[model samples]
Target chain A: MKILVCVSKTPDTTSKVAFTDGNTKFDEAGVQWIINPYDEWYSLVRAIELKEKDASVVIHMVTVGGADTEPIIRKALALGGDEAIRVNSDSTDSYYIAAQIAEIAKQGGYDLIFTGKETLDYNGSSIGGMVAELTDAPYISLATKFDLEGTTATVTREIEGGEEVAEVALPAVVSCQKGMAEQRIPNMRGIMAARTKPLKVTEPVAADALTAIVNFELPPAKAGVKLVDAENVEELVRLLHEEAKAI
Target chain B: MSVLVFIDHADGHVKKSSLEALTYGAKVAAQLGTSAEGLLLGTVTEDLAALGKYGVTKIHQAANEALNNLDTQVYAAAIAEAVTASGATVIIFSHTPTGKAVAARVSAKLKAGLVTGACALPDTSNGFVVKKGVFSGKAFANVSINTAVKIISLNPNSYMTVAGEGTAAVAPLAISAGAAKVKVTAVNKVSGDVPLTEADIVVSGGRGLKGPENWGILLDLAKVLGAATACSRPVGDAHWRPHHEHVGQTGVQVAPNLYIAVGISGAIQHLAGVNRSKIIVVINKDPEAPFFKAADYGIVGDAFEVLPKLTEAIKKMKASA
Candidate 1:
């Protein structure tokens, strides 16, 4: 079995969002880049789980980013991916990114494709579905748990009010969410082996750019707190009614 | 051309988000020089025609025993058929779970361009462009759908539900519904009045509340406000609250009109899930807690001492009003 996993380079969770070059684009300066938490934890772990279940299964990881993103890609390799592919494209638009990943999946003929339910940065969650369509493969998003026995895979996912159990045949795409697996940290041996792991760099496939970001601005900072003094219970009630108006 | 909006429900009752979608679709159809129609699947106990007051001119339904249960494959096929047969140029669905699954499938089947998690009406000026969240809730992306038929899945709580005096003409579309291959033998419903994700107002507490027994104060405030109850990720993990009540990066992502965070330090993970909220009220004793930096309103007081008093005031206001 051949599986392909999609990863994205996003700002570390703690980075303060800012823009550069006169605020026209997101300022990448001094920002620590990491595998999008969702894709790293859920999608990568589930892919490793599949490889563990079957010895012949080969797990491959790929990302669409600039040359600088190679380190994050290597970290994913250290986490257990057998091989890696990097499409040298730094485009942030979902359609352009999807086009690049879709071209790779089409060329590779992967039996299964895995991506996080959505990336922390481009919360679109639309790419995997689009890639599935581009590949003419069935798509299942937000699977919490999955098992493969034969040609078909049964996936259990959480919905708005309840859970759903679905089954689809092979040669499909599935997006992973929280309950798929816990986040994995690469150890020393895996990191050393990742240095020699097959990391392939390829030119991006030409595709139509569907959308682009016009500008990015930080969310407005909030004001200071209105402390009512913990001991003054009456003052707190007065504040709630007069100031908050929510009560 | 007509725009069809799917009304999602649980146990035969329409959800608030569905109504918001109806309002959004109606406005979109009017903008596109078309009629706004609605499609009600599953069994709903509410009068369908009355819902038309929100802007729908007609409500087409397929209320079957099997339809009452959510089967994405069956739903996708049914809605796709409806769109094709009804001559629907634009089909809208709330980005809720059922709608998410069905929208993608129907778009693929109908060969339509789908833009999910749309925060507002399409930019219908030069062409059809939908603004959607790109980096989770961090940034916005405008996607242009240059297709004849367009599919849009609106994000929950983004569009306000506008009500006007419009009575809907009810019609049951005669279409064959597919069978659900997956069967649900039983559903163990979570014991809670307000679903954490769907609530317009969410009242969540963290370790600041002290312990599980002290949760009543939080619950009382939430109940008085008609708000859903949630907890910080740590509190939920600590078993102070049920897992379903967890709201943060690893838990549910919500964009309610109002989010009330009590005792939480406003961790980045928690803020990512709820930063899109229209208004935020943070009540934490620590004046320097990170949550204060994002709150529209911040109250510094011991929750045990403040929350109960706030609940009592709300109860009094509700009773007098």
Candidate 2:
């Protein structure tokens, strides 16, 4: 079985977010990057698990970013991926990125594809579904559990008030979240092997973006919190009803 | 052309978030000098005509039992057919789990410009700019969707529902229900009175609650306030709470009308999941806890002492009313 796992680089959770160029672009200076937690902990790990169960299963990691993102790809390779593909482009649009992945998937004829449910930075949660549509393959979002037997795959996804247990055939797309798999740190042997693993770079196919960013603005700073005495609980209720009107 | 709102439902009733989307779509239609219509794909026990109070003039029901469960590919195809039949210029969704899964597929099938997690109405004064959260609610982006057809999925709690006196005209719309590639075998419902995603108020605790044994106090508070229960990641990681209750960047992100955090020193990841909430109230022993910085109200006290008192006070207020 061959699986393609989509990876994205995001600012560390603790990074102080900033914008520049009159709030049109993100300020990348002084920012530390990490493999998005969802991608590392859930999507990639699940693919690695599937490979572990079957010796012939191979995992390929793909990302659409500049060369600076190679280190993150290598990190994913160290975790378990057999090879990596870097789509050399700054992926600012979700549709264009999906189109690029769709092109690659069409050419490779991968049996399965995985991506984080959504990126923390943009939180679009659109690419995986779009890729599924473009490829005419089944797509499952926010899958928490997955099992595979031969050509059939069973996935469990959380929906409103309950969980939906779904079964789809091979050659499907699944976006993963928590409860799918536990995070795995790279072992020393895995690290050494990743250094020699092939990291292929490819150009993006021609595709037009449907949306454009006009500008960026930071959310308004939170107002000073009104602190109420621990003993004066009613005062808190008064403020909730009268000032905040939250109740 | 009219505005189309997708009315998501489960357990035979329309979800509350759909009402917000309906109201939002109606208002958008009002702004565009058009009418608002709704598309109901599955079997529902609710009165579809009663939804007119939210501002939609017509409700289109597919009444296909196969559409009862959410299958993204199936839903997207049916909704696309409805869009073509109704000539809907703009489509609205509530950005729930169902919406997140299907909206993109619909957009792809229709080749429409799609925006999710939208926090406000489109700025039509410009060339159709929609405002949505970026950087996980730490920043906002004004996105211009330059497509003949546009799709907007509003954040769950961002829009308020405005209802008035009216009944909608219910009509059966014919559309082909594509075969679902995935077969659902079973459903395991989360055992809670309110689903966290749809809850108006969420009362969450953290490690500061000490242990699972002390959760009774927090649960009591949640019961009094009629809020769903949640936990910080640390509590879930420690196995003191179920993983489903964990709310953070890696967990379930929620945007409710009110979020009450007890004993949780808001980590950046935790805040990312909840910063979109309309109002936040934090209670912690340390006044310098980072959660307080993002909170509208703070109470410096121990959770053990605060939980009971706060619950009692709310109970008193309710009884008097």
Choose the strongest candidate by TM-score: 2
TM-score, candidate number 2: 0.98
Question: Which DockQ values do the candidates obtain, in the order shown?
Answer: 0.34, 0.80
Candidate 1 local Cα displacement, residue B280, angstroms: 1.6
Q: Report the CA-based lDDT of candidate 1 relative to the real structure.
A: 0.79
C-alpha DockQ for predicted model 2: 0.80
- Positional deviation of residue A149's Cα in model 2 after best superposition, in angstroms: 1.5
Per-residue alpha-carbon lDDT of candidate 2 for residues A121-154, written as tens digits (9 for 90 to 100): 8889998899998998889999999999898999
Candidate 1 lDDT over A104-185, as tens digits, reads 9988989889988777765667667667767767677777787888767888777665566777778888888877887889
Collision pairs in model 1: A121-B135, A122-B134, A122-B135, A123-B134, A123-B135, A123-B136
Worst 10 residues of 2 chain B by lDDT: B184-193
Tell how far residue B58 is off in model 2, in angstroms: 1.3
Query: B157-271 in candidate 1: lDDT tens per residue?
Result: 9998899886899888765865665444445456557776688889998999888988988888888888998889989888998766788876788898778899999899898
Candidate 2 wrong stretches, greater than 4 Å: none
